[model samples]
Target: MDDAANPLRIPPQMSVYADKHNLFHLLQRMLTGLLIDQPEDPISYLVRLLQAADVPKIMLLGPPAVGKHSAAKKLSAELGAVHVTTDSLLEDQSELSAEARQYALTHQEIPAELLIQLIKRRLNSVDCVDKGWVMEGVPQTFLQALRLQQAGVIPQHVVMLEAPDDVLLERARGRLVDPLTADVYHQTFLWPADDAVAQRLEKRRDLPEEQRLADLQRYRREVTALTSAYQHVLRVVNSDQPITDVYQQVAAFVKTRRYYRTPRILLLGPPGSGKSHQARQLSEKYKMVDVSCGRLLRAAAADGSAVGDEVQPYLDGGTPVPDPLVLKVLDKRLSRLDCCSRGWILHGFPRDLEQVRSLQESQHRPNRVYFLEVTDDVCLERITLRATDPVTGERFHVVTRPAPNSEVHKRLRTRPEDGVDTVTQELRLYRKHTAALQSVYPDAVHIDADQDFHSVFEALESRLTAD
Candidate 1:
């Protein structure tokens, strides 16, 4: 490819590194900001943008009397983020449309379009954009949330405050607002420390029993939609608890970064360590493509593709496919949309140091590597005792999983490779390269395959989702 066509002509490994570190995402975000702002000093704008990457972009979402305002204020103070809301945006009508300005004065509820417009303007401001912001309870409806997202007002963390209906009602009844500072206080839950502040505290009267109930109902109905919109970043907090406890939980969650990971998983272990079985389980559950290297080679050869033709002779001769050919088949298989989007869990390849290096250099390097650890004795027994029902292609173990009937048992066939001698050789080869493989992926999850199938799966699942 020419420089004009493939500008930087970055090495394949560079693409892999960028993907792993989310560098492309960062670049896209910076470019998008540049185009949107059209800043004269692009370099400085990008520097500010990079500096703002970790700044908190938070949303406090909850029903009435959930203490969202209080939480937003506390978080804003802690993180030095701008506390943004409908009231804050409406404070200065200079940026608002004439209709929104009029509504800011007279209307109890701003229309979705006007509210979204105001929020966009406020969040896009230099202060909010560079310093980050905490949006406190302005988007009371799903439509408002959707519109805000469409306008690029995405929150890095969505603190979904939840409380029982009774608790909310009681909170609303006890609500008090300070005239001077506009701080919220409650009769049982919270109170002002200073006598002067208590003396000036005014009961919140606008939210009557009927209004509170209606608001709660509306929130309950719209909360599901909000969750769907921000599910990835949303963390539910039991706001019925003490405000301090709630803040701690919300703070811990907000401090963590969110990653949009595309799961490229690799399973490695000796024969009968259940790599293929576990790969299938993960693939089925997580909707990732199960790329069994041996099976893929067979399919490729059957498909009559160029790669298949090159590797077919080796397959026919029962010899190992060359590293280049295996990598070729893998590159073609893993680059497909299904693997790229839905992700993939591959096994039965990259069995040595050279293969590992080749894979690391490839564009689709595995982010999640797992070694299913099983004892040699267990591996030998598991492989030697297992037989396949040729008619149904169902695997059966002689000791653990017997054939369903006499006919099936009689028809069950064991592969020549599964013989004790062949499995022993394979295990020996695996052991020889195991240390180097471990060195390559020191952080790879080590799953104990000696346990039951379900236990091994749970271990893998925990690691897969704990992120």
Candidate 2:
């Protein structure tokens, strides 16, 4: 394209002798180029192209688990911008005035006055003012959006991640959180690798189904008003597909351009299916972060936070933590990192259909799900031979990695449930709960785990790289 025809290209004369009139002319030419053979709304396209040089101030609106945060982070990284979320801002109350912190601690929800003050401070900060930013979890209501505009914190674009109510609920249900790190995980989709970490995970108690539905209904009501108020710059994306696909759509809308998206992979299987091993290998090979929900949960339980306090009782009793609680823990962890920018391997989660629904609802659905298939006999054998270190919770195989001496063997412990009878019982439970996943995740790539490690790993490598 010629300089005048290229939206991103500026002619030398325009730069050296630019005046208000010349700048206007340049913008006019860029608009004409952007509009050429384009199907997008002209005004919206023009607005986005005009803001290309300025710091991006974007607002991401969506129900919980709709991947708004993920999209925001990805866009921020892509544009060398900052990613801001109200939740993160609130979590570190030390930055706020004493009165604001006190009020935030006492109230179930921060009042608009307090929120506005904090948000204004954040927007005026150096990072947001100098660089662009993708902001999430604020301006929840039409009034809030207007208030932000009144405070001179206007967004150039307002993007909404849209999904069905049923999908939202399922995603809400599968949410897991690690109270320690505030990482989020989906039960059927993404989890930690260690069982101990799984033990500390609890469903997001704050997002019960009824509450989620209510919030969703409220969002629908507010969105009607908000979208109408900001229709010129509003963009809506259907987020029911895989997260990467949804991100691509959002990115295109944001830049008024297109780019390739990285894939997020999820590994699923019963106990002893070797999902963790594969996740580690894949993470190393692809430079993807390995989020082991189980490890996060365990850390949370040990971390002595409120979430850990709640999880200890369940772990002590050997009972499963509620799905909602687990989701909450995972959510916290995911929020703290750059999962979208780096991509990730989700391991040891979504042991049931409810978890699968949660993954879908949350907009954190995986690009590909690998279900490691192993026979009951093989799983039982692996479980039966497993030994644990009481102090460290490390696992050892009696045959493969036995203690080096009698003194070391004396210190090793085996779970009472790892006995042959208990192992059989566990296999039956796995079959009862997880076997149906084969049908549920019809698109999942299945690999035989009963084979030697090299064979199984090779199959996985081939399938993953083929894409």
Candidate 3:
């Protein structure tokens, strides 16, 4: 094989023995270093070395509510791989037997043979074959693993998530599923703050505590044995820590599997909180395009594009753009950014809870959201002091970037909305609309925008670059 095509050439000594007992012993020796140290970096050096030879086909295995599916979805996003959940596949089966459908809806495992068939069909699809895939909720038993291997659908790596039973139970209790969208929501963590969606979601019926414990016990017994058989390709991740920390561990492994993807970042803040400024700086530093929805809308309206024509009147009259138009422009701009390969920083969209839901529904959600927090007084003060250059459209603070001379000062322009009363009203409106977003995106990183620009940038950079 060409060196470019096969980056990490597998040594001839590495072999899969036909005898099960001998195969287990071979895997045990190969994985002895990983199983013993259990280092903070879960992805072993050998695993990284092997992955360079092939596209990653990852399998996530864990007990119920331990976040296996969530981690798989995230890894898929980061790697640009297709996410294949066995539960989703079962739900999508048009001719699924009523018995199978009933079993899928409950907190119990579907039959291993049935699940193996579903997984086999999905793995053969063009999407999975072309883009590679990260799958979860399958191969919970040794039989399923054997069947998968026999069908030539073995995973390149298996991530086994470990979490305390109490944490899993608490997560399971709050789990809600949208039967229509097949979207899972957690009451405590992932549920929408908006009353409309929250009220409409069907809470999943919880199994009795005794039965739930029994289910966990059974899952542990089966999965432990199954994973032991696949120890050569296994990586164990601790899931009881903060979600970001867990994501970091998984992402480290994924990075070794594929080329790095550009980071998709979203910035949220009230007007005058300097979100645009921070976004621009971060984008430049990170080599990502800065895509401001408000800027895109204005440019489109000025250019008389189809969307601009519809939105021109609103912009000319200083009216808030309708959600549909905003989303339309956003989608168009994002499409043009080549963000899947090039990365972008999104700003001035998702201003309210409804927009958040709409963004999620549209499937263009950001990988991470940064909420710039600033007090109203500081915001108002900054707006009052802000001046613009009509020719360049550059904003300047009176104290920080004041014009050098009277002749230069004469070219500065003040926005109509820069008055104290106008700014105060705008700030009030911002608070009213965005108050719920804090609750909706509770996991968004809160950056203290009240600090100096350098300090704020340092904090943001540290979070992005940390491990």
Which candidate comes out best when scored by TM-score?
Answer: 1
lDDT of 2 by residue, 1-467 (tens): 11233244333233323322334434544554454426367776565545543677788888777767667877888988777876656655454655566665774566677788787777656677678788886788888877765655656677899988888777777888777655566787566777777888878766456777778888888987777555546778998887778888888777752122334678887777888888888777666778897886787799767877787788888888888778867655543324544456888677777877776666455767788899877887788888887766778788777766776677888788778887677667667877566666787898889988889888886565223
Cα TM-score of candidate 3 = 0.46
Cα lDDT of candidate 3 equals 0.72
Candidates 2 and 3: which is better by lDDT? 3
Return the top candidate by lDDT.
1
Per-prediction CA RMSD (Å):
6.9, 27.0, 21.9
Worst lDDT 10-window in candidate 1: 1-10
Winner by TM-score between candidate 3 and candidate 1 = 1
Model 2: worst 10 consecutive residues (lDDT sum):
12-21
lDDT for 230 (candidate 1): 73
Count of residue pairs whose backbone atoms collide, per candidate: 0, 48, 0
Off by over 4 Å in 3: 1-261, 389-394, 465-467
Give the runs in model 1 whose Cα sits over 4 Å from its true position.
1-12, 34-48, 95-98, 101-111, 138-142, 206-208, 257-259, 265-305, 312-324, 332-365, 368-465
Q: Please write out the lDDT profile of model 3 over residues 91-171, one tens digit for every residue.
A: 563555445677866756778767766776776566776678898867778888887766556566777888989999999
Error of 1 at 446 (Å): 11
TM-score of each: 0.65, 0.42, 0.46
Provide the global lDDT of candidate 2 against the true structure: 0.70
